[model samples]
Target: MLVRKARLPDADSIHALIRSLSFDGTLLPRTFAEICENVRDFTVVENDRGEFAGCGALHLYGPHLAEIRSIAVTPRARKQGAGSAIVQALLAEADTHSVSCVCLFTRLPDFFRQLGFAQVDRTALPDKIYKDCANCPRIHACDEIAMARGVLPDIAVLGPAQVEERLIPLQL
Candidate 1:
């Protein structure tokens, strides 16, 4: 299998893969337009035959934080190291951008733990809270665990004050 930065032509496959997982809320649903608009953020894995196997995206909030989102592998590609390769490639991309932290929300903590992520309080990720969690359909009943690799950012650019204020009651 091979992993590489996603190209425009890969958008349909990536959209389908993410949509397949989103049906049960395994991931947030993304429109095909969203995938195309942010296609540069995605990395895709292809089987030896050069067929699309899986994909993941790295959304950089800044030098302070980057997020791994929309990560999913086709059912047939599971256990073939495609997922791991995609993640490593994303992390490398983060490193190239000098991002200090990488975060993700996942139901599969064990999978990410093996990849060097540790559980972190969702509130500790203010930028994420502001960007997605604040309006997430599952906000009050979220099942995904927040995890991070590397030092958590000390600051947030997107409404940190508002995120903190809103999250306070949730923590209580």
Candidate 2:
């Protein structure tokens, strides 16, 4: 399989993969518009025949915090290393940008553990909860685990104390 930065033409396929998982409530739903707007954040994996295999996105929240979102592999492509390749590519992109840390909310903690992400309390990332989880239907009964990797240069950038102090209630 080949992995590369996503292009506009890849949006439809990426959206389909994400939509399939989201339909089962395994991931957050992303609209075609949303995918297009953040298209640059994604990396796509394509099979040798040029079929889309999987996709993931790195969303920068601030100088020190970025979140990995919308990771999904085609069901037929699962266990074939497509998921790992997509994540590795996203993390590598994060490293290239010198992002201090990468965070994600997922049900697959084991998968992330293999990628060096450690389980973190959701409370530890109030900013993320406030920004995304608040609007999520599962917020009150979330089954997803929060995980992170790398060192965040400035904890204050997303510290709960700081987030509360500068809190602005609005839909993000």
TM-score, model 2 to reference: 0.87
Instruction: Kindly list the per-residue Cα lDDT of model 2 for residues 1-172, writing each as its tens digit.
Output: 9999999999999888888887778888889999999999999999889998889999987757789999989988889999999999999988888888889998999999998999987776666876777556677888889899977434534444554655667667
Query: Model 2, residue 87: displacement in angstroms?
Result: 0.7
- Predicted model with the maximum lDDT: 1
lDDT of each: 0.93, 0.85
lDDT of 1 at 9: 100
lDDT of 1 at 97: 97
Stretches of candidate 1 off by over 4 Å are 160-172
